[model samples]
Structures are given as C-alpha cells and as structure tokens.
Target: MRNNWLIAACCIALPMATGAIAAYVTIQNVQFWYPVLRKPIFTPPNAVFAPVWTILYVLMGISLYLVLREPPSPKRRLALVLFGIQLFFNFWWSILFFRFHSIGIALLDIILLWLFIILMIRQFYRLSNKAANLQWPYLAWVSFASVLNFSIWYLN
Candidate 1:
C-alpha cells in the first residue's frame, strides 16, 4: 500500500516537474517575444495559460498514476511508453515555439503531440476507463492549441 502511494506521488510529481521546466523555458519568450507576434483574434489572454496548464498537468499526472497502478501487462507497457512519448513532445513544443521561435516546426510538433495523446488515451482506456477519461480535457486543450499554433504560424 505504501509502495502504491509512493508510486502515485512520483507519478504526479514527474509531470508537474516537467511542466515547471517547460514553464521556465517559456517565461522569457512569453514576456518578450510572444507579445510581438501577430496572433489569431481567438487567442486567450496571456494570464490564462499558466493556470490552465497547471490544472492540465495535474490531471495528466493523475491519469498516469491510474494507469501505472494497473497490473503489469503488455498493454500497460504500451500505454506507459505512449505517455512518455507525448510528454516529450509536450515539453519540447515550448522550446520549439518560444525559445527557438520556430513556429511552423512547433506546429508540427504539436500535431504529433496531439496524435500521441490520442494513442495514449486509447491504451489507457484498456487498463482504466477513468484514467482514459481524464485525458479528454487535455486532448481538447491540445486540439485548441493545435489550431492556435497553426494560426500563429500562419498569421505571423
């Protein structure tokens, strides 16, 4: 039981930590570079991003924890692998868009990220439906983000 709790803690911490690192990379660019870009009119206020991302990260952590708690199986392994892959793309999207200012490339990365999220959710469903359902908001947000990303690239 203690081991399960510890694993849960680690699961939550890992994604939150990843978000923190990505946020660090994003802050300066968001302040200095992002303001100057020609964004789509639908863009949310800058103030909205942090809180939204924080919540999403927490949800993602919980989703991961639920999946990780499932019995060991090839399906579980695949789900875990998909989660890690999507997280990698999620982290790097900040660097690609904000730090490097490669908006087009960032759009590509985000599309891939979105696909991986779908794959992850599908696999998670096999193990835990709640875990899979938790990812829907994340997917919805990323779907919006993908449009936002493409718009940013197009307009700018």
Candidate 2:
C-alpha cells in the first residue's frame, strides 16, 4: 500500500536526517578543530569517514524501520525508546569529539554509546530478528570507533 511505503520512507528518513544533522555539526569543526589533533596511528584517512558513516546511517535507518513495522507492544515500545537513547549518544559523540574537542570525554561517551548499541541490538532482536541483524554493522562500527576514540585520547 502507498501508506505502508510512505511509513517506511519516513522511518528510514529519521536516522538519515539525524546523521545529516550530526554530520553538519561535525563538518563545522573538522577542518579547523580536527586538523590539529594528534591522531592515532591507525586513524583512517579523513575521506573514509563520510562514506562509511553514510552507509552505516542508511543501515541504521533500515533497522529502525524494520522494528517500527511490527505491531506495537510494551516490549516494542521499550525497544524504540532504547533506540532513541542510543541515537542521542551517537549524535552527541560528534559534538563531544569535534565541536568541544574533548577527546577523553568523547572516549568515555563512545564507550557508553557502544554499550547502548548492544542494548539496542538485543532489544531489536526481541522484536524482530532482521532488525537486530541489521544493527550488527552499526555495533561493529561503534565498537571499532570506541577503540579509536580511546586510542586518540590516549595517544594525544
């Protein structure tokens, strides 16, 4: 149905829109704020971040959409709330790392973010396996990002 398609589109748009807003915030500080940092040895090239985040954001949107398509229940509602909380952490990491230029705080924030992602994934699994599966890439990325954040904080 057209309505179903529209709902799906909107669900997908939510995370993508959040990512876009986060990216906008990050870019504002990256050039002047980021360049001076003492990056870790394994830090990926600057160009790698945008494409990787774009794909991850799309996947995140798809995962949320899958969860939203299911019938509403208390468990489902709780899962949605968890998803939103993790997203807040996700969005703020950029602000902590880039805008405020606080690497140590960013590292701590990202560890919390990684834990939230795991909780979100488990919650998603209870509602929809596909949704939970879709979040694995995000979990993996955030896990990696957590280590990177720690390394940056430690090295710098």
Candidate 3:
C-alpha cells in the first residue's frame, strides 16, 4: 500500500514538475513580451491560464498513475512512450512561444502537441477508460489553445 502511494505521488509530481519548469520559461516573457503580441480576442484573461493548467496537469498525473498501475506489457510500454513524447512537445511549446518568441513555430509545436495528445488518449483507452477520460479536458484546452496560437501568429 505504501509502495502504491509512493508511486502515485511520483506520478502526480512528474507533470506538476514539468509545469513548474515550463512556467519558469513562460514567466520570462509573459509579462513583457507576451503583452505586446496581438492575441486573439477570445484569449482568456492571463489569470485564467495558471489555474486551468494546474488542473490539467493534476489530471494528467492521475491518468499517468492509473496507467502505471496496470500490468507491464507491450501496450503499457507504448502508452508510456506516447505520454513522454506528448509531454516533451508540451514543455517545448512554452519555450518556443514565450522564451524564444517564435509564435509561428509554437503554433506548429502546438498542432503536434494536439495530435500527440489524441494518440496518447487512444493508447490510454486501450489500458484504462478512466485514464483516457482524464485526458479529455487537457485535449479540449489544447484544442482551444491551438486556435489561439494560430490566431496570434496570423495577427502578428
């Protein structure tokens, strides 16, 4: 039981830690550089992003924990690989958009991120429905974000 709890904690921490690192990169530009961009009118207030992402990361972590708890197999390995790839894209989006101020590149990164998310969801579903369901909100948010990213690129 303790081992399970420990594993769960580690699972939850992984994405949360990734978010923290991405947030560090984002903070570098969010105040000064980001304000100058011609964001889409539909863009949420800056205040909305933190909380939404926080929730999404937690959900992602829980989903990960669920998957990790499943028996080890080729499917499990593939799911883990998919999760890692999507996460890498997710982290880099912040760096591309905020740190480097490359909106066009970030848009491309986000489109890839969105696709990887769908693939991850499909793989997760094969293992656990609850795990896959948890990813829906993340996907939804990223979908909205993809449009927002494209709009920002187009406007600027």
C-alpha local distance difference test of each model: 0.94, 0.86, 0.95
lDDT of 2 at 36: 77
Candidates 2 and 3: which is better by TM-score?
3
Q: Across residues 1-156, which tens digit of lDDT does each residue of candidate 3 receive?
A: 999999988998999999899999779699999998888789999999999999999999999999999999999999999999999999999999999999999999999999999999999999999999999999999999999999999999
What's the ranking of the predictions by lDDT, best on top? Answer: 3, 1, 2
Q: Which one is best on TM-score?
A: 3
As for lDDT, the candidate ahead, 2 or 3, is: 3
User: What local lDDT does model 2 show for residue 74?
Assistant: 92
| Superposed model 1: Cα runs more than 4 Å off | none
lDDT for predicted candidate 3 compared with the true structure: 0.95
TM-score of candidate 2 to 2 decimals: 0.95
Output the lDDT of residue 134, model 3. Answer: 99
What is candidate 3's TM-score against the reference? 0.98
TM-score of each: 0.97, 0.95, 0.98
